[model samples]
Target: MNHARKVHIALNVTDVNRSVEFYRTAFGVEPVKWKPGYAKFDITEPPLNLTLNHQANIEGKGALNHLGIEVSSTAEVLAAKQRLREAGLEVIDEMNVDCCFALQDKIWITDPDGYRWEIFMVKVQDTQPDLTVPQGQHLQACCRQ
Candidate 1:
């Protein structure tokens, strides 16, 4: 596999400082570029180019579906969960859960703008491609054992 470039995403936030703090705590890294009403994070291992730009018309701008970071190990997932919790952020943990056709251990965190961020580690690959989760239950909420 020749994955060569980082994924870039720019988000419009009502408050830049708050979002920066939240992402900094969640990713355990500081933004490579930070300025008034703008910030950029150059994540290496995950290869993400995340940017937050302050805007007055942030509302009614269509919500982001969600964002996720896939890690390599269970320990990494647990560490990220702990770090988020320590930063006074609400984290929901799902261990050994099947989601998106893969078994994973993950933690979910919602940002100030209601953008959900999931940190996960895949443990198993699913052979079946069923996409139906139960009614009133989400993929993130499927790990109740």
Candidate 2:
């Protein structure tokens, strides 16, 4: 929303090769550059500069809560779910879910290295959650992140 045109994320992975494969399926794009212990994906679909680094001892690698790609429509989210499922990856679809003071339609997936990623589009912003379930059944408003 500022002057930034692309978002860059450098990840520490236990195995670059495996992470590359996971990302390839997740983003539906291959790495533009690859080298020993490193791979880079210059993605255009989401305008991301994603890189994978081989970390011999990356303790709490998955501790980095989660990553996400925010799309513009629910249809795009469904399309992503379809594409990800076709790639043999496990996808968790959560539609019309309220979280973080907003409602969204999203899908979740885990990479080979335990990184949780989501593809989501916000539906309603700055509104309180309003589902029936309670206590861990759904994500409550905590303003996380």
- lDDT, candidate 2, at 138: 19
Instruction: Please give each candidate's TM-score.
Output: 0.48, 0.49
Best by lDDT: 2
What's the C-alpha lDDT at position 67 in model 2?
68
Every model's Cα RMSD, please? 13.1, 13.8
Tens-digit lDDT string for candidate 2 (1-145): 1212455465767667778789999999987655555556869877886767555666855524356676778888899999999999999988888654458788988899877777877687535324232322212122132
lDDT of 2: 0.66
Q: List model 1 lDDT by residue over 11-51, tens digit each.
A: 66666678888999988899765555556686876788676
* Worst lDDT 10-window in candidate 1: 136-145
- Give the residue spans of candidate 2 off by over 4 A: 1-63, 129-145
**Candidate no. 1 TM-score:** 0.48
**Displacement of the residue 38 alpha carbon in candidate 2, Å:** 33
Candidate 1 yields a Cα-based lDDT of: 0.65
